[model samples]
Target: MALRPAPVGTGIVFTRIDQGNALLPAAYDLVSETRLGTTLRNGDGVGLAAVEHLMAALWGCEIDNLFVDIDGPEVPAMDGSAAPFVFLMECAGVVEQGASRQAVRVCRSVEVIDGDKRIALTPADDFSVDLLIDFDNPMIARQSSCFHGGSFAFKTEISRARTFGFENEVAALHAAGFALGGSLENAVVVGEDRVLNEGGLRYDNEFVRHKTLDCVGDLYLAGAPLLAHVDAHCSGHGLNNAVLRALFASDRNWKLEPVMSALPSWSETAVAAEA
Candidate 1:
């Protein structure tokens, strides 16, 4: 896969090189599935999977426009964290297009409830996330995290948190065509009573941190930076997408706000090459 620069207002687009260069805009309305991870499909039925991590990295890096060229159905699961992608962006370098940035500002709260799980977005001056997760496994009984958006905060606090799974669910997940590429090298494996990874958790609350990372990625599908406070509990990819749908259900829920400057860590003007 390659990350290429896009013209201003291009947003984030995934180009399926292997599928005749089918263009799939990374937008919430195009989301086709969220069983194991997020998937976006075009009108041709061409689809891409596991885009959450990469999307999160783009959001964290403040990459407003880019073209992702890939040859497979899923993004590479490098370390199962957004950290690698962040590094790639740093290596590729970010340049601000000569255009003002735009954001989706929530005008009111929108919520989705499913049993004990729920997610909501409310008006805020900046993007932030408050997320919590609960699992039956004692190793991850309950974990909570909050993120106030910025490249530094995401890279240092959220990007290194790797995806995790339960040992017992491997077979079922495999049968369901999920996590076919998952392994100890790419994901944290929780065994009967402990983390099976050699180094254990990156952070004491890494599980929740990773979930927040995923939330950041999932929410970026809104097509612009969000100026809102996201509150979620036991939310996964599906619920994240559902909340986005709810947020855009009415014109009264959000408005686009234009910022006259570029994000920090980037020049106010320049051009970027494909990386």
Candidate 2:
């Protein structure tokens, strides 16, 4: 992973250097689909996958401007979590730019549901997330957690939460010619009341926490920091992308503002200003 300083107002863009110099703007219009993970496609056939977690880390850290150049179809699934990506960014050191930071303010509640899964964005002075997950497995019956955005605390609390899967599903994934790089080192595996992997879960509720991590990343596609309270239940990458698309589809639901150096506190101002 590499961090390159971006031009003012560039936002976070992913350029597929492998695909004939195509640029995919990290926005809702570029979202091609949500299959196993979030995917973005440019008109020139360049695309990126599994970008939500990295996006979340950048957004959560309040990095408003960046240019990401990747030479592959999918980003390196380093340890299958966001912690490594966070570490890389920390090592690179985030620098403050002369440009102002912009944010998307949610003015109303917007929600999307597919079957029993649902995700919602509500008005808030600051960005926050509440995530809930339910699995049939006994180890991960139901889990939930909340995060106040812009807090790097999430790096420790949730970033290391690993992607999980069942043993039966692994065979299917291989047959489909995916996860060639996946292994026990990168993913958590469970089988019928027992943890198949030698190492157990990093956290008791890692499943839900990973979902929260994904929410943070996918929501960043708004192309700006957002001030809203997000609540989600048993949602995946597809649903999260849908929620973003819904918010942007209606201009009445939200507004984008350029970053400002001076802003009133949430309690002091009737409406929070961009920063």
Candidate 3:
């Protein structure tokens, strides 16, 4: 797949170049599946899966409008992290268009609970997340990560953290047709007592960091940048998307705010390109 710049207000959209140029908007309303990953389906029932990593890269890089051209049903899982996508975006360069940035500001807290999994969003001036996870595996007994969005390095902290799975579950996942492309080169495989990957981990707390990264991508489907403090526990794509739905179900819950001085890193490039 390839990503290209779009005009102002275009938002993020995926185009099936091989399928009659069908376009699907990357919005929560179009989300049709979120089992192991997030999937967006267009009106005609076409879908694109494994989009969380790409979405997180776009969100982190402050990319507002873009067109993704794909020829398959799922995104290429390059390195199983957002780093590859981020590198591509950087090489293509970011350019701020002549339009005001916008965001959805939360007015009240919205929460979703499915057994022990929980997710919530509360009013805040900036985007932030506090995530926690508990697994029976000793390699990842309990891990937590907190990110004050836009104030840290997404490249080093989150982009390199790969998705993890238990060694014993690899066969089942493959037999079930999930993670068909997953491997040690793209995922962190954990055994009963140690990491199966030769390269250990990018961070000691990589588990929670990657989860936090996934949460950021899932919530981006809200169709706008978010200005809210998010707290989640043992939640995956399902709960993450649920909180976004709940937050938007009520008009009183969130309101769109025009962003000022958006895309600072890309402003120079934009100006230079236009000149």
Find the candidate with the highest lDDT and give its number: 1
Report lDDT (Cα) of residue 71, candidate 1. Answer: 100
Report the alpha-carbon TM-score of model 2 versus the true structure: 0.90
TM-score to native of every candidate shown: 0.94, 0.90, 0.93
For model 1, the superposed segments whose C-alpha errors exceed 4 Å read 171-182, 260-271
The predicted structure with the larger TM-score, 1 or 2, is 1
- Computed on alpha carbons, the lDDT of every model, listed in order, comes to 0.89, 0.77, 0.84
Model 2, which residues run further than 4 Å from truth? Answer: 258-275
Question: What TM-score does model 1 achieve against the real structure?
Answer: 0.94
How many angstroms is residue 73 displaced in model 1 relative to the true structure, after the best TM-score fit?
0.8
Pick the winner on TM-score between candidates 2 and 3. Answer: 3
User: Which lDDT tens digits does candidate 3 get at residues 1-275?
Assistant: 87877787888889988888889888988888998799999889888998898888888878888888899988888877898888777777778677777789999999999999999999998889999999999999999998885714777688878888888899788888876754787889999999988879889999999998899889988887799999999999989998998998999999998865544643312111210
Cα lDDT over the full model 1 = 0.89
Per-residue alpha-carbon lDDT of model 2 for 1-275, expressed as tens digits? Answer: 45577766777877777787688888867788787778888887678988887887776456666777788898777887888877777766666655556779998899999898999999987778898888898878988998774546777787888888887787778889966656677788777887777868888888888888888888889887788999899888888888888898889999976645463211111101111
Q: Per-residue lDDT tens digits of candidate 1, residues 191-248?
A: 8899989989999999999999999999999998888999999999999999999999
